[model samples]
Target chain A: MIKQLFRSCIFLLVLNAALSSCSNNGVVKESSTADKMGRFPEKGDMIMLTDRPPQLETPLNIFQQDITPNDYFFVRWHLSQILTKIDIDTFRLYIGGAVDKPIAISMKDLKSKYPADSVIALAICSGNSRSTFSPRVPSGQWGNGAMGNAKWKGVKLKTILEAAGIKKGAIEVTFQGMDKGPLPDIPVFVKSLSIDHALDGEVLIAYEMNGQDIPMLNGYPLKLVVPGWYATYWVGSLNTIKVLTDTFKGFWMTKAYQVVNNAEANESPDSPAKVTVPVSHIKLNSIFILPEPHQPVAYGQPCHVEGLAFNDGTGIKKVEVSVDSGKNWMETTLNPEISKYSWRRWKYEWVPKTIGINHLMVRATDNNGFTQTSKQWNRGGYAKGFIEQLDVKVK
Target chain B: MLKKTQFIFIATLCCLFLVLHSCTQQKQPDIAKPADENPNTFTVKGSVREIFINHDEPDFPEAEGKEIFTSTCTMCHTLRYISIQPNFPHKTWEAEVNKMITKFHAPIDSVRAGKIVNYLVTIKGVKQ
Candidate 1:
């Protein structure tokens, strides 16, 4: 009888252990969905979300509010797989190049020395319109959600440069990120900027994005936030800082990231021009998020035509919505609380009076009087400002 | 003796109940077929044909392409971006590939570019 009791206890223990293992196995299987979607950073995986389209369906009108939640912010990384951990204390920012004093400032010092300032600026991809090009550009074929508005909290770039004492003859200020990955034989990923632009009070070495510490995918410890500049100028995992006495040349600065004018007279492999200098400010662009692609909407019903708009740094002067192609247009009311660097939300209440396919178009103009047009196109597919027109079947 | 037997009997019964409960709770390997499952798996005759007609060739030899794509293509986007696009003519495809080298700074070249474009056009391109 005693032996039987002992055997019974052992059996129960074994059963419990088996059940626990099975449950763990089930969890492992479920977690693979994100991995399969390529969201998980693995050995040999590039850290940039640019490595693939985001798993979430991109929301139209990315500028609905001032603060873009970390999860929703469109991610762009040049190199390094997703950073899982960042230690802020030990992290140091190196500021050098044509400076009276090249200095390395720790995270703690950066906060203590300068009065913290926040700015709202649009960070857009230079190749945001790669898909619309005659020959589809090969990159993340982002359908308009690649840009977002976030209120960045940090000390101004000029504040840091002034402390270091900007020297004369500094043609360009190059920034290198701590972000590292296997680049064939190369060991690092870096980008640079002109000294004039670096001294702009708006250029920031930001510690916080949208009122919080930036998430790992969005450059956690620190990142350069060049307001109104394309993301290529915004270097992540920034580690090396150099002041170039001559023109800065690297894979990113020179051979790659240039807008080669195949049609221009001087267009050649050796003489390609970098698209880094801010060209035309961000042209007016908007997207309809509520009625998603191919979703049905009822005819003769009140529908909210909602989206976001921005005029780069100039600020939006006006936004217009057209329900009948471009034949008719109406002014859209802007959301007042939107951040300056973030996108401005706009809405026009529309009742589709007719029952056919309604082509809806949206356009905007900045304070500088630069209006949105459908004719802009570049070889690299940069700055595609064509009006967003959505086709919906009205029942 | 009788008391001991009863105790043993109760303990055995409890153990049996636990064993049965655990077996029942074990997640059965999904018996239901997912809506998108394709049951028919077959080997393709050749790489080009498989890519062209079946639209099912790995972008590169599984080992080489995956590494190159991860290093180069992923600098800016995921593999699905390539997989999701409707295939285009070679000329249009070349222009698209060059845009990465030129605009977004993707680290691909004529040789790798040719391989990637061939694989995409064969497998992912919309049939003309």
Candidate 2:
């Protein structure tokens, strides 16, 4: 009986050792703290994000302010070698060609001669909603943060040209920024403006933004702030100001930013024509910021949904939110109107009554009765306006 | 019978001690050598040493550049705005840099401009 008990005890000890080893092998390593806190994509990941086509992914929050901060501003560089620093002195802005007397003015002279003006304007990429297109276009898949509002202070373009003395035969005035990149034909960064539009009082040569000097990213020292126009025309590090004799044919002005309409309508290779014009006026559009995409919420809990809305020329009249897939809509409360050009913030409280998938859609109506709708397909992928939608799952 | 049981117990304890002692004495297999020897060394030539060293210091001079960037650039804008652009070549960069001084009036001269460019080139410039 004693011998049998000893053998049984040995067998039990071996079995316990084997079980412990198996458990050790099956152990799952605890996730690191860094994994828990999702940091910005490391250097290797930026390329992946840039190359991958834009999807319905939420933008990574980089700033503490309700408004997206400037550093964390989404980058959209068409060409390479964007500028960093500039010397303000000895820098000359030439206003010639269509002007009676071509005037070259120094920075000091510009400040002293012209009256400084400030206006808060929203600078948005013309292709802000490009990714929503059916066939994804090839460009920076910018999220909503591609736009921002700042108080721009500068001399109005009309004031600058009036002093220069405009001449006839000057149908357009060309504005060239110091930003230079190599093109297939011309190795320079330049754009032109129509004479009538160039002389508009709203067009300005901005030196200050948000009560401070403009940052390098936003065109430090000086940048052109064409109120209500897309940022593509707001040339940065402006170096040349020429009064054009005729229509400007710069690469960006003519070839690149143009929208080619009727591509399928006309099957010919050259059937489509260049849009070649700066996007004017903000379209009525809204975005959903809170309860990010695919975020889960407790059943029957009130979720606050918020977003921003703005228009280029007209003021935003109302922003409406729909939870039942646009069948019914409710007007959201608008934050205090900051500036005519800056986007107005809006929010709505939503309580999910049922435990299921809910589709949320937001649409904005401008003062002029223009509402956001699906964009017509074009080659240049300009002015895409699909209704922004979000899907949320509730437990 | 008791004497025989005590002897058996002593023998069993001795056997267990010998087995444990032998197991402890057995040498663990030497750790497998790393697959590749030169792990950190770059395959290409021409000093990666400079890049490592250059990146070590905060590209912007902590005191001077910050002061100049804030006082001048921030007068009209924020420093966060300027740092966004990737670096550029000297020529194209010169034009934009001059715009601030000539068009915007940043109070920078040729000497100061050179310093600012040097600082910016280190931080923002893309490697050719």
Q: Which candidate has the highest DockQ of all? A: 1
lDDT of 1 by residue, A1-395 (tens): 66876686677767776876665454433124332222222111111222322222234433445555565666665543434445565678888878999899988898898889888777777666456655455555666766667778898888988888878888888887755553444434567778787877788888888777665556666778987767777776565677777887677767455553422111223344544333324545666665666877888888877877765566887789888889988998887735566677788888887787989888988777767775545445666676878887788
lDDT of 2 by residue, A174-249 (tens): 7776654432333356667788888778899987766665555456556888877777788876767888777787
List residue ranges in candidate 2 displaced over 4 A: A1-68, A183-187, A260-278, A374-376, B1-128
Residue B1 lDDT in model 1? 39
- lDDT per residue as tens, model 1, B54-103: 11111333533455554566555445456545456676666777766665
Computed on C-alphas against the true complex, the DockQ of each candidate is 0.08, 0.02
lDDT, residue A223, model 2: 86
Chain A TM-scores, one per candidate?
A: 0.79, 0.78
Interface RMSD of each: 16.6, 18.1
* DockQ of candidate model 1: 0.08
Q: Local distance difference test, per candidate?
A: 0.62, 0.59
